[model samples]
Target: MRAFVFPGQGSQAVGMGVAIADASAAAREVFQEVDEALGQNLSRLMADGPADELTLTQNAQPAIMANAIATLRMLEKDGGVRLAAKADYVAGHSLGEYTALCAAGTFDLPTTARLLRLRGQAMQAAVPVGEGAMAALLGVDRDRAETIAGAAVDSILAERGPPLVCTVANDNDPGQVVISGHRAAIERAVALAKEMGAKRALLLPVSAPFHCPLMIDAATAMEAALLDTDLSAPLVPLFCNVDAVAIADPGAIRVALVAQVTGIVRWRESVLAMQAAGVTQVVEFGGKVLAPMVKRTAPDLAAISIVSPAEVEAFAKTL
Candidate 1:
């Protein structure tokens, strides 16, 4: 069986999806749809980047989703590869979850685009700039990373007052984990990780503390928006980031989407679960980020990432 995965934030860059859109009319239509839905020239921002403007959370969230969906369109229209026939399961990272759901027919492209826009705005507003941060710990397993994070939070709580929170945000792979929360606690975790023999621990260039208790306000915002949005059962089960399990129910999917704002992305465990479920190959759509993580998590499983039109055609040939 094959599982199709979509990349989350941090994988986006200037000029993303341009190649596919140039090569296929279907891809262009996808971009046009997203541009109309958001009521702005997002496609221009993605193709011709001022870098900083494209990197804003509000733009990047839906821009990444548009790129992924456009790539999927390329595969379908040009390559004759359909998800219902070729994929057994679908999963995505962070904001990419919206892309996966859109790909699986859970929501229409316009709805997904609007939802991500709101999600990005809500998450950005959840925490003010400079107050929260995220850090990645390299060469550390999940257990050690958790230990370091806990110690950092405890130390901060002893010295600082309440509302200072730090927690593991992502169990990305066997060798990498990301922590997020208050800026001071995140900085403290970085220093503590270095002292505890971690190879490297550095802060990410993100604007908000994602997947931490600090995002409770964002979660609440999403809850209200999702309640009004329409969601259907996906064509394939989704290995949710928050639970690391396959979910099919629309109501359950809604809850997971809301809770994922402050929940750890159990990517490592989700890959392991897919492997246990007999997924022989993992195909990553949109960006190349998750392919490497799948390789690290399950080396035996064939993993591939498709982004450009040439890559899409090449993958189609295999199908």
Candidate 2:
């Protein structure tokens, strides 16, 4: 069995999907539709970067979705591949969930693009700049990472510091977990990580701390937005980020999507679940990031990343 996965945020680059778009009209149409939906030429920003602007949450969210969907369309049109025919399941990291759903035909391209634009803006607006932060802890399991984060927050309260929050935002793998919350608490966690036996910890370059309680406002916004949007059942079950389980029901998908805003991304568990379900092959669309994580998390699976026409052609042959 095969599972198709989409990458989340940090996988985006200055010139993503250009070659594929240049080579396939199906890919270009995805980009063009996204631009029309968002009322901005995001493809231009993606191809010709003023890197800073392209990196903003609003831009990065839909831009990443566009790039991933374009790659999928390229694979389908140019390589004569079909996701529903070739893959047994679909899953994605954080924002990539929307992309996975879009690829599955649950949400049309335009609706997905607009929803992501709103999602990014809402998340960015949830917390004040510099007051929140995220950090990646290396060489620690999710359980230990959460304990360390709690220790950091406890230490702050012990000193009569303002009560702040610190929690593991993403359980990415056995070796890497990301924590997010108040800037002070997150910084404290990084400082205390090494002494607590974690190999290292460092702050991420993200503009907002995501997948934590600080994002409750974003979750609320998404709840409202999703209430008004049309969501069909996915062509395949999605192993969602928060639950780490496969869900085909639209209601469950909606709840998971909202809960994911303030819940830990159980990526390692999700991959394991897919493996347990007999997924022997994992194909990552548009970005190379997730394939390595899949390899590291589940070495028994054959993981492939297809971001160009040639890779698409080669992968299509296997199907």
Candidate 3:
């Protein structure tokens, strides 16, 4: 069995999807449809980024999805690869979940673009700038990371009123975990993680604390938006981030989508689950970010990252 995965944020770059779009009209249409849906030239922003603008939450979310979908389109049109027939399961990291759903036919490209635009806005507006932060703890196992996060939150609660949020946001791999919440709490967690035997702990450059209680407002906003949007059942089961299980029900998928806003992204467990389920190959679309994580989590599984036209052709030949 094989799983097709999509990448999340921090994977976008200038000139990401240009080659695929330039090579295939189907790929160009994907970019053009997304641009029309959002009422702006997002393809230009993606291909010729000013860096800061492309990095904005609103832009990055849909841009990453577009690149991934464009790559998928190229694979289908030129490489003779079809997702519904080839992939056994689909999953993604964070915002990449939307892209995975897109690939599985849960949502059309226009709907996915619009939904991601709203999701990015809601996530960004959940907390004030500079008030929330995220930090990565390296060389610390999940158990130690959890203890450090708990201690950081408890210490803040003991000293501060109205309690503050601080907890593990992502379990990226065995040795790397990310914590998110109030800036002070995250800073404390960073310090505590190092004292708890972490090799290093450093704050990330993200705009807001994600996958924590602070994103409740974002979750609520998503609930409303998702209710209004029409989502069909995905063609294949998705290994959800919140549960680390494969689910194909539309209603369950919606619930997971909303909960994932403030829920820890159990990426490591998700990969392990896919591996245990007999996924022999993991094909990562759009970017190379998730392939390394798949390698770190399950080295036995063949991981492929399809980016350029050559890589796409190479991957299709193997299929």
Candidate models: Cα lDDT each: 0.93, 0.94, 0.93
Off by over 4 Å in 3: 159-162
Instruction: Pick the lDDT winner.
Output: 2
TM-score to native of every candidate shown: 0.98, 0.99, 0.97
Q: What's the CA error at residue 198 for candidate 2, in Å? A: 1.1
Q: What TM-score does prediction 1 earn? A: 0.98
RMSD of 1: 0.9
**TM match of model 2 to true structure:** 0.99
- Candidate 2 lDDT tens digits, 1-319: 9999999999889989899899999999999999999899999999998889999999999999999999999888887877899899999999999999999999999999999999999999999899999999999999899899999999999998778989999999889999999999999999999999899999999999999999999999999999998889999999999989999999999999999999999999999999999999999998998898888899999999999889988888877
Best by TM-score: 2
State how far residue 189 of model 1 sits from its true place (Å). Answer: 0.6
